[model samples]
Target: MQPHVTTALQAWIASWTAHERAAQDVMEAAFPGLKPTPAPTGCCDVQMRWERDGEGSGTACLDDHGRATIQFEDVPKAAVGHAMTEVFGNGWFNEGPDGFAGAPPGKYCWEDDCTYAECEIDIGDDGLAAVAISYVKIEDVVAILDALETGLEAVRPSA
Candidate 1:
């Protein structure tokens, strides 16, 4: 991973941890009967793996709880649409913005029994393209993260 992207991911993780702490503090203050759930040591320390393919390279940032973001780099706008289609299925695409003559790009969400995910796209003349896959739900996230970690570690060192 690039230094800047790694830094950004670290910052993102820190923000999530701080927000969680703040929220828990408020809950504890409000409800004396509320029990604090102890997070495992270094639970916030995520292992990220980067993979390169013909389409683009991606970074999979996995937290211990199994939540993750597989962020693709330098993907074309058309490929982004195709990926979203694969995630949401054939008919689910184009359900967002029409991408008409003046309509701006759109964001769409997909959810199932175990997880919720979203895709955001930006299409314009600036020549920037990107795509991402986010995994939600605590258990599902953790399982996916663990599997990816194990698989990647077998092939290369994880940073």
Candidate 2:
């Protein structure tokens, strides 16, 4: 069976529940091909949070200007950031409710537009693997997705 959107969503939520070692495990568990390295200090930071039907996770790096530039990578380690972020990187990575709470500590609110949510997973040379989900309620789409573009933006990393 194909991987479900909720499954991916849950996997993202579940990653924060685990300890450091366990976070590595959760990372490995979420992506079969992931290769994680110790996150260098000042290089990367993580944020995780979860809620009922609406939940999300993201990572934001500190820019040269000391500003936080939020970006989404396919793998937790972002080993293939060039590829993954390119396919799925149009989000603000908010600060409340599973938005971005530093090392992705616990519980968060999911922000994304509902009705029709979409994100493309990059699979290297095979092109992009698409993940699109439709909802009966428009609020589900709005509240969950928050009208975030699933496309990669050129200003920074992938879309």
**Would you list the C-alpha lDDT of every candidate in the order shown?**
0.44, 0.30
lDDT of 1 by residue, 102-125 (tens): 224444334444456654444545
Candidate 1 global lDDT: 0.44
Error of 1 at 64 (Å): 1.5
RMSD of each: 16.6, 18.4
Off by over 4 Å in 1: 1-46, 49-58, 90-114, 124-128, 137-159
TM-score of each: 0.38, 0.22
Best by the lDDT measure: 1
For candidate 1, the per-residue lDDT at 140 reads 37
Candidate 2 off by > 4 Å = 1-18, 39-42, 45-159
User: lDDT score, residue 87, model 1?
Assistant: 34
